[model samples]
Target: MAERIQKELKEIEKNPPDFCSAGMVGGDIRRWQATIIGPPGTPFVGGIFKLSLTFPPKYPMKPPEVTFKTKIYHPNIDRNGNICFNILKDDWSPAYTISAVLVSLCSLLSSPNPEDPLEPQIAAVFLKNKVQYEEEARKWTAKFAMS
Candidate 1:
C-alpha cells in the first residue's frame, strides 16, 4: 500500500494535473494535502481550494476519503466540506489515480452536478437561478477561498 502511495505521489509530482498539486501531509504516507487553482471563467476562478485525503490500509482497492479544507460554495460540497461525487462513492475503481481525482474535482468546480448535491439549498439556487448562484459562489470564493 505504501509503495503504491509513493508511486502515486511521484506520478503526481512528475505529471500533475492542471491547476492541482498534492503531497504527503507529513511523514505519514497515508495522509495527503492538495491544492486546486479554481478553473478559469468559473465563479471559483482565482480561488485556491485546499483538500485533505486519507488513504485506507487497502488503498487502490478502496477509495481515499477526501474533503475540502478550504470552504467552497458549491452545490456538491457541504458547509463541512464533504463532497458529493460518484467517483468518491460507489463509482470508485482501483484504476483511478490521485491525479484523476484532482482533475475530476476541478471539473466538478467548473461544472457542478446540481441534480445530486450535498447542499440542497445551493443546488436549488443553482437550478432555479444560475446568475444568483454564481454571484453567491463568487462571493464565497472571494471570502473563503481567496488568500
Candidate 2:
C-alpha cells in the first residue's frame, strides 16, 4: 500500500496540476496537504484553498477522504469542508489518481453542482440569487482563502 502511495506521490511531484499542488504531510504517505488555486472567472478566483486528503489503508480500491482545511463558501462544500462530489462518492473508481482528484476539485470551484449541494441554503442562494451568492462567495474567499 505504501509503495502504491509513494508511486502516486512521485507521479504527482513529477507532473503537478497547474491549478493545484499537493505533498505528503511529514513522513505519512497516507496523509497529504493540498493547495488549490481557485479557477479564473469564478468567485473564488485569487483565493488559495487548502485541503487535506487521508488515504485509507486500502487505497485505489477506495477513495481518499478529502476535506477542505480552509473555509470556502460553495454549495458543494459544507461549512466543515465536507465535499459532495460524485467522484468522491459512488462514482469513485481505482483508476482515478490523486492528480485527477485535485484537478476535479479545481473544476468544481469553477462550476459548482448546486443540484447536489452539501449546503442546502447555499445551494438555494446559488440557484435563486446567483449575484448574491457570488458576492458572498467572493467575500468568504477574500476573508478565509486569500492568506
Candidate 3:
C-alpha cells in the first residue's frame, strides 16, 4: 500500500488539478486527506470541501472507500457519506487508479447523476427546482466547506 501510494502521490504532485489536492493523513500510508474546490459554473464554486480516503489492506484488487468528511448537498452523496457513484461500486475495474477515482469525483461535483441518487429529496429538488437546488447547494457549501 505504501509503495502504491508513494507512486500515486508523485503522479498527483506532477499534475494536480487546480480544484483539488490530497495527501496521506498524518503520514499514514493507508489514509488520505483530500480537499476539493467545488466545480466552476455550479453553485458550489469557490468552496473547499474535505474528504477522507481509506485504502483497503488489499487495494487495487478491491476498491477503496471514499467519503466526504465535509457535509455537502448533493443527490449522489448521503448524509452518512455513502457515495452512490457506480465507479465506486459495480462499475469499478482493476485498471482504475486513484487518479481515475478522483477525476470521477471531480466530475460528479458538477454533474451529479440523478439516476442513481442517494438523497431522494435532494434529487427531487434538483428535478423540481433548479434555483432552489443551487441555493441550497450553495448554502451547504458555505456552511460546511467554505469555513
Candidate 4:
C-alpha cells in the first residue's frame, strides 16, 4: 500500500494536474492534502479550495475518504464539506487515480450536478434560478475561498 502511494506521489510530482496539487500531510502516507484552483469561466474561478484525503488500509480496493477543508458553495457539497459525487461513492473503482479524481472535481466545479445534491436547498435554487445560484456561489467563493 505504501509502495503504491509512493508511486502515485511521484507520478503527481512529475506531472501535476492542472489547477491541482497534492501531497502527504506529514510523515503518514495514508493522509494527504490537496489544493484545487477553481476552474476558469466558472463562478468559483480564482478561488482556492483545499481538500483532505484519508486512505484506508485497503486503498485501491476501497475509495479514499475525501472532504473539503475549505468552504465551497455548491449543491453537490454540503456545509460540512461532504461531497455528493458518485465516483467517490458506490461508483468508485480501483482503476481511478488521484489525478483523475482532481480532474473530475474541476469538471464538477465547471458544471455542477444539481440533480443529485448534498445541499438540496442550493440545488433547488440552482434548478429554479441559475443566475441567482451563480451570484450566490460567486459571493461565497469570494468570501470563503479567496485568499
Report clashes for each candidate as comma-separated counts. Answer: 0, 0, 0, 0
Model 4: lDDT equals 0.93
Q: Ranking under lDDT, best-scoring first?
A: 1, 2, 4, 3
The residue-by-residue lDDT of candidate 3 on 85-113, one tens digit each, is 98888887768877778878989988988
- What's the lDDT for all of these models? 0.96, 0.94, 0.86, 0.93
Alpha carbon deviation, residue 75, candidate 4 (Å):
0.5
lDDT of 4 at 116: 97
Q: After best superposition, candidate 2 residue 117: deviation in angstroms? A: 1.1
TM-score of each: 0.98, 0.98, 0.94, 0.98
Model 3 has an lDDT value of 0.86
> Is 3 or 4 the stronger prediction by TM-score?
4
Best by lDDT, which number? Answer: 1
In model 1, where do residues sit more than 4 Å from their true spots? none
Cα RMSD to the true fold for all candidates: 0.6, 0.7, 1.2, 0.7
Clashing pairs in 1: none
Candidate 2 C-alpha lDDT tens digits along 1-99: 788889989998999998889999998999999999988999999999999999998898999999999999999999999999999899999999999
Q: Tens digit of lDDT per residue, candidate 1, span 6-31? A: 99999999999999999998779999
